[model samples]
Target: MDATTLNSQAERFLAELHRSPQTVRAYRADLRHLTDWLRETGHGLEREALEAYFTVHPHWASATRSRKQTTLERFCRWALQHHLLDRDPTLHLEHPRLPPPHPRGLRREDIERIFAVIPPEQTRDALLFRLVFETGLRIGEALGVHVEDLDLTRGDEHLTVLGKGSRKRTVLLDDPRLVSALRRYLRTLGYTHGPLFQATKNGRGGPLRYQSVQERWQGYAGRADMACTLHQLRHSHATELVNGGVSLATIRKRLGHQHIQTTLRYAEVSDSTADAELRRWRRQRH
Candidate 1:
């Protein structure tokens, strides 16, 4: 079949799946790129054709190429299952080796400066930002927190969060300063129940939307002149724990990482830890 026809099939396939809009868009783009290459080379969507295309167009970054390869493989598998193709072309396709970059986290100085610059009037923003940094919680996980999820009573203090894949995990609320901030913010909101972070409208309460928090975060970033993301707070927290000699298993559990490899990325980012290891290695060599 022609590239355009196959491309349309791919689009229809993706539209029927329960994928996020962003994911659908990316998959569609990947499909389009593959079809375009096939058309240019006068080839069918076959294994040999794909291998040739990758060989000829070897300019993509490893990560980008890997993503595209995954997208194409999924598409090919679907096509084969649907009888659009006689066989799956991606069954034996090898993805390019990905060189994982060091995880980027905010410097201690940057974190301090940013927190210090948070205006007193923006207590909610301050609390949200600090909460994520203190507990390696993703922005979505932080925003998803309900009042009932918190256990700030005298003896125990932790928040239960629904992490990726709807898995639940308990994260400690260990910082007294953060606990104080949360208490004050909750008091100001007069919210004795429901979402810990709430939206106010006409003196009524509702769940605070992610978009509103993102807009507020943009303003905070601009004021602090820090080009960082809310997600980076999670990375910063994880890196801090790793550098402080926290065990990988403990860090993985705290960060809700399914794999220790994900938590190990923080260790990769800790230059001080790397330096210490290098010193140990040199002493051993001597």
Candidate 2:
């Protein structure tokens, strides 16, 4: 079947998976890109057709192509499961061997500058941003978090987040401040279930829009006289872990990175930090 006519089947694929609303919405958007490509090229969901679509925009950054590739690959896998195709076209597909963008994690004081201006009353903003920074979660992942996803059970405090490819992984609420902030935020939530961060515009509660979150973040950065993106918070978290000598394997799982190479970008530490690590390693070896 042509991807151009995937609305119904795509909806089915999305519905069968237990993903957050934001994830579902993001997946749907990616599917539409595929649908448009099929309409223009009049090709079915074949391997060559998908490859052509991916290369159509060579100027597109590797990250953008990777996201689309992931979305299409998942759809193809679903189609195979339901007998839509005789073979999985995306089964042996390989991602382009382009180096991922160098991670731009911020320093502690640089991050603190942004946080210093978050008004005291914006407790929700504080908790939400802090969670992403501490946990290295994609902004969408953080926004998708529901109240029920949290497990603050005594010493085992953690968050069960739905990661990429609809995979569920446990995110430990390892930061005492984060756990404390979470509890404080929960107490102020007034409701027992639903999104952890609800949109409060016009005295209404609903799924917070991603755009709204970014806009609010920009405002905070402006007040602090710094130019920062919301995603930099995640980058900063990864950088901190790398500087602290955390293993790449652990960082990969913590950041939900698909490849260790992606985590390696965060390993670009300052000269002093790298020297310190080498010094400690040599002393231990001696």
Which model scores highest in TM-score?
2
TM-score of each: 0.64, 0.65
Candidate 1 per-residue lDDT, tens place, 1-286, comes to 5687787798778977688999989988888888888788789887888788788877888888899988887777787778888888877778788877676898878876777778888787789889999998988999899888888875568889999999999988899999988777767866567788877768677888888888777777777898877777888888888778788899999999999877877764467787987898999999
Clashing pairs in 1: none
Question: How high is the CA lDDT of each candidate model?
Answer: 0.83, 0.86
Q: Candidate 2, residue 108: CA error in Å? A: 1.3
Off by over 4 Å in 2: 1-100
**Which candidate wins on lDDT?**
2
Candidate 1 at residue 127, lDDT?
A: 92
